[model samples]
Target: MASEKTNGEQEMPKKKKNRNEELKLHDLLNDVVSPILFPEPTNSAPLLHRIKTSLSRNAPLIPQASRNTARDTLLWTRAGSPLRPLLLISVGTITILALTGLLVFTLLFLFATINVVIVSLLISLAAAAGCLAIFFACVTVIYIAALLVAIFAISTVIFWTIVAITITTAWIGFFYTVWLVTRKSLGFAKQSLSVTSSAISTYSAAWGTRNLKHD
Candidate 1:
């Protein structure tokens, strides 16, 4: 029961806030629409009619062209007699000069553009030639360097081969010398042994003959 009372109290404030928001929205709409529906009256129509009547009554009686010429003549006479013709002539002359200047400037611009294009083309050609020359030079240098590297490699190989050949020759010569010395020593020892054996056998045979005679 207490919880229900508290829930009802919370819902009451939300409903009141919604009612306030709706009332504010309605007041804003009324304030915006009231002036458009009921605008204040003005005296502009009478003033505009008075202006049209005054203009029609005070308007010129002469044709428009004659009126303009009359006005121009009056102004010219008040200023000076010669100024009117001079002004017309000067305006025409200025227009002619402006057209001539425009034509001359166009021709000059075209000529300058052609010259610029030609100059740029020539410069590009020169630059391309320079680049090609540099490329060829680099290629030549690379070829020369490669040739030098190949020569160096070949020379190193030849030097090592010569060293290997010299080492092999020295080894062969040392072995041959050792074999010759061993062969000479063995031959001398065999000859001495054979001579000693023959001498001993002859002495033994003489001894045996002497003994037999004595007996």
Candidate 2:
């Protein structure tokens, strides 16, 4: 009991750390993706003031070094931008795909579980009959029947394995098709963000150099 208590105490910090990390990731993803899928509206003010306001709210998710890059992304994705429609489409696509995948997985798992139970029952019955045949070695029909049932059980396993592979391939093809449909918009958004990140990095470097020369 003491050892168990010590182990529990040791594990508490690790669990807390994991929870904190998850929360941080959740916040970061929310900041990045929410700007696109669900744009936030800042009060009507000067551009710089609005940017500052938005940055204040979302800056904690990023490090100081990347704050400017995050700000640039925020500007591009803020409400009233033309990218909203693309955002809508991508978000909708992802939502549908995730739900459908969950549904497919659930049904497949259920089917496999049922198949396993049925197979187990058949195998058990075959084993019992085989044991009886051992007692009555003269019973040829019982032996043949047991062999056929064993064969059928093995065939069922192979058939389900094939079905599972075929289903997985079909889902992969479907996901690939959906990705192809949204490829352009997704590519465009990522490229735009990359450009903005580069621009911010260049600007920061130049400003730092100028400050150093002055000092």
Best by lDDT: 2
* Alpha-carbon deviation at 167 in model 1, angstroms: 1.0
Pairs in steric clash, model 2: none
**Top candidate (TM-score):** 1
Candidate 1 residues lying further than 4 Å off, grouped into runs, are 1-128, 210-215
> Which lDDT tens digits does candidate 2 get at residues 1-215?
99999999999999965744445434655665555444547534665655565567666646632554545545666754444444544544555655655565566557655755665566656776876535444344455465556556655655565566556655665776687769978999999999999999999999999999999
TM-score of each: 0.37, 0.26
Give me the displacement of residue 172 in model 2, in angstroms.
24
Cα lDDT tens digits for candidate 1, 1-215: 99999999999999965744444333434433443454347533455564554445333322443445556656765686444444454444555555655565566557655755665565556665887556655654665566556556655655565566556655665676687788888898889888888888888888898999999
**Model 1: lowest-lDDT 10 consecutive positions:** 57-66
